[model samples]
Target: MRTIIIQKRRQAVFIGVLCVALIGIASPASAAIHIYTIEVDAALSRMEVVARFAAPANAISARSRDAGRFLLDARDCDNGDQISNRGRRLTISGNGIRCLSYAVDLRSAAQADQRNDLLHASNFLVTPTVWMWRPRLGGDDEIRVQFRLPNDVQVSVPWRPIKTTDNAYLLNASPQSGSAIAIFGHFDSSVANIAGTDLRIELLRVAEDIDAAPIVDWIQETAYNITLAYGRFPNPAARIVVFPIGNTPWPSDSPVLFGRVVRDGGETVELLIDSQQPMQSFYEDWTATHELSHMMLPYLRAEQRWIGEGFAQYYQNVLLARAGRYTENYAWQKLYDGLERGRESVPGLSPNAAASGDERNSRMKIYWSGAALALMADVELRQRSHGKESLDTVLDQFQRCCLPSQRTWSGAELFTTFDSFLELPLFMNLYRQYADAAGFPNVRPLLGQLGVAVDDGEVRLRSDTELAEIRAALTAQRYTGGPGK
Candidate 1:
């Protein structure tokens, strides 16, 4: 059985935070705190938003939907207000209305391509962009969003959960990695301890009786695989939202549908699972491991997305091998095949061009170009420092310096930062050669030197190669955590 920790907060503190009303004090308006109280209906079909600003606001606006699609209907203004119903943003102008109230249709807000399920009266999902509206905030400003729900209702969000209050969270400006999901209603939620991090996981309600134990156990193991990169997991507090999508109903029999890491409010790994599949199959799924590996670095911009995706691709296989999921030879085989695919992708297209242009046509290039660079850097670091340095140590240092970063980073900036961590600058040099240069990185010669031989399309490992030691050190397990613990 999976462990479930029911969190409790003092009612007094909760009421105190909610009771922070408009004091009408003669204080600096910017210095006052803004409060947003959200009341979820008993049926969980809709929600009422009441935003109370600390002082009179110059203007209030709703987050615009993508492609000029309007999702919010603003009505019932308290004070003499001017409402501008632009398809994207909802601008409200009023001097008398201190608090704004609006009704949000939950079903309409929950409609998203990834959400693939019909909105039920008891269960639905949404992101903050759907209904949240507030005054513009400066650098030093913050907003408090509190949720009021019925006894059976619960809320799961990517924001930092407030320990002192019930159903409340704190939100700040962040680089969104797609819209972070917020589940409102009943679900199977649990907290697992993995490498000193408390990962809160919520499995949404499904028709089938989804066994929480094996699912959670798989999650714990996958997260532990990421710890092989460093001594601990990347983020101390991250959320994992699991949605059961039933069995594959095909020949693959893969236990996971898909998984993605969203860094909007906070770090969240959303996974789609096949509930009917056997528990043992999930241990072999790489989606969760790949998604979790993305947290090793901060969110990068779209043009530099290869850096994030490539690092993730490289780490997933390496970490899985270290975790005993794959033998050392099998791991090398997978890596060799992946690098070959990347090399064979659309010729004469630089990684940046492939990424910023039609990525679907150049998916392999975008995904593996970075992996090739990672492998090259790892080998170089290992050889230069005589086994004292590697990508693992560099990433560990990076975690110590900057991680769970709130802003977006470019490839150049990230490479420069990596170079700073090393005694000999290395990352930018690789970037210069491969990022904008046509053709994939030529790592075949380096692989041959590392003793990875492909005979009749079958990878054969040899021990007499010059860089065999470095290759061994690349995927060697550094952590003592055993499998199936």
Candidate 2:
């Protein structure tokens, strides 16, 4: 009966189209061609979006939560059809409509400060979710967005750049961990080359004066640090957004206040920094290094966040040491302290449970359990292959096969995939022993075997232990090019 109904509906639609064609009426054009002309005002706080659809669209929407509130007006550009604004989505239903235009007040939707810091200077930082509203397209289809910016106003976005013009980009589906930031204001922008990756860096405008060269150098150094894992950086094109929070009253003496890796439309490393801090302080801070380390793996599921965070935490210390920012002893000491914190955060909870449980107090456990396992895996791989196979080699293989992925990955799946890169299975064994059944993967025994002795929280490195060579090799600068690494 359902098949018969579908057939009748199809026949009626075909007959209607045939009658329209016989009467010299043409069918609507295909919906694959979408062009968005985004106009930014001279003040850089308002955006007018004119989305031209090839055919009438049934649904059009913005992507961010509460983004609909900023829509000042929405109407069909051709026949003035009514458009509905419901939360983050906009709905349009009309015949033979080709254009939809909307105006958004970017100042209201822009984030004044990042990471809960209220004292920073008021600057415009609007993500793409706040301003871009268009018809949804298929996975294979892409939208061409052209920005018409006023003079003295610059824009920064994470979309792929189109070569013919400076302000046009191609937008496609992405694994949106968070909103990809779009900066439209007076800000410093430049490109830095790391291996073959051309990293676009945007430094937000602030009251305090900042030296751009040193910050670029610091970013370059961090990128080089990540290349120690593999010969090249993970993504060919990534973005870095720097928000200055130094003028604000913050207690930390460190240069970087906070950093996070947001894999939205593209991979973006957002760094909140103290611009007043000296150049050396920027290089000394591990926030950028840790954030960049996250790019080595695809975005994991929320329940499997331990693996992502742990891998980053482990790599931060090791990579910083390789970059010569941290002494070998200091790196080991930090790792030991971190693993100890993980072990004590929730005594009975497993890594998976800790990640899924209340994050208020179990944050340490969620961050470090995977780090402990990473250390075990690295040490075991190095021991088995006699310096040929380490965590770096396994990750190299993983990156070559699957990276810049568009989907979320479970921890079990990630580990099983990693296990496929080796002669013997190693990652799943570690996951099985610790992921759900452990307080923490007991790394104390492994530490002792690696000759990382901690006396009163001070790491003492010894050369005579069984796995001492592997410990040194993990932090040693193997890929030496570009900067300190």
Candidate 3:
């Protein structure tokens, strides 16, 4: 049997009279039944949901413990729905058995709000949020319900269903392994060309050809790679649902690669792609890969976005390079280019610090420059440990320390995690100089030891001798860590 925990928090009482009048439903009766389901029809741009409940005898009331007015809209309710007024029972029922059901339609623009509210509610914050009702048998009186997505929308990935004895089911979108309401996607080869784990192309205009086969292969490969590079997470049974939605337009405020992490009954990571772009372009696929990496490093908060975005950005390039899409030199060159651009723009600022207030100012030095710093650190570690240890090992260790239930970390914790792996104080100094500081350090000079040369607006290898050594170190067949790590 599968067990799910739902925490309840007190909030302002919902006024049912106003809700019933807005939705135009009758008063609810005691015999009314409650049901919950989600519909994602192509004809409907937004997700439409119906929540049904029976009305009480004297009064009808339909109330949500955590769902907010902004996120949820009540299309209809009954007189059975009543709100508490001044700590006294307020009866708003119309007399007969009321069959009240709430119809909530989700707008595409509201995706971010839905994600934030759902995550916060599931984490016990009790702001307005969405949830699937699960029924218990003869124990606690709880509503049971089933959720449905379009079966015609194919999912290529493989996942095992979570065992449950409850009469109701709680469906959620997540990528963690062994989750109760895990969702997966499959590809339709007739509509899109599949290249290993990457989709060669997909056309959003044609819904008939929407396939997830290519993405499934890619996710499986990525999961395998992560497991091979690092051990399984502490929660081995956690299942992550993979939703391969058609590439959508990039949000004006954020890059196309950005996605949201939702903590509900199950963990969810939504990968939004830009289908209009060329499939082979790095920008097209990097977003999916980068967001998926968050599943392993979700403990990062706004303060530690450097570790989150920087590491993901760095690894995205590294993975693409290892896949033979780009040469190692090209990847390094891209990092150098981003570093130069970041340095020229701002001296000391967190890239995402201003994301909450000013979107433009949020573009700080950390993501690109910090990634460059990580690359340099990786090079140094490989050199010091003679390829016996790598950044992947350090990251895996760090995830174990900070991710899971902790869900947040500081710069000091990051440094301490790295120090534990390398047993060195340099990690502390590096954190202070780059991660915790407000200015750029002489990172290019430090990279000089690896035969990299940084001149005015250019980064290049000092000599072919140095290039060959670095190449050998990176490409050595017998290297301890795998290629992408």
Model 2 agreement with the true structure over 314-360: per-residue lDDT tens digits: 99999888877898888999999999999898887887887887758
50-102 per-residue lDDT for model 1 (tens digits): 66666776466655454124334454334424355465455545553466666
In order, candidate lDDTs are 0.77, 0.78, 0.43
How much lDDT does candidate 2 score?
A: 0.78
TM-score of each: 0.87, 0.86, 0.56
Question: Which lDDT value does model 3 have at 471?
Answer: 38
> Among all windows of ten consecutive residues in candidate 1, which has the lowest summed lDDT?
1-10
TM-score rank, highest first?
1, 2, 3
Once model 1 is optimally superposed onto the true structure by TM-score, how far is the C-alpha of residue 459 displaced, in angstroms? 1.5
Q: For candidate 3, write residues 312-375 as lDDT tens digits.
A: 6776666545544455666567666766656654564544342223445446464665575667
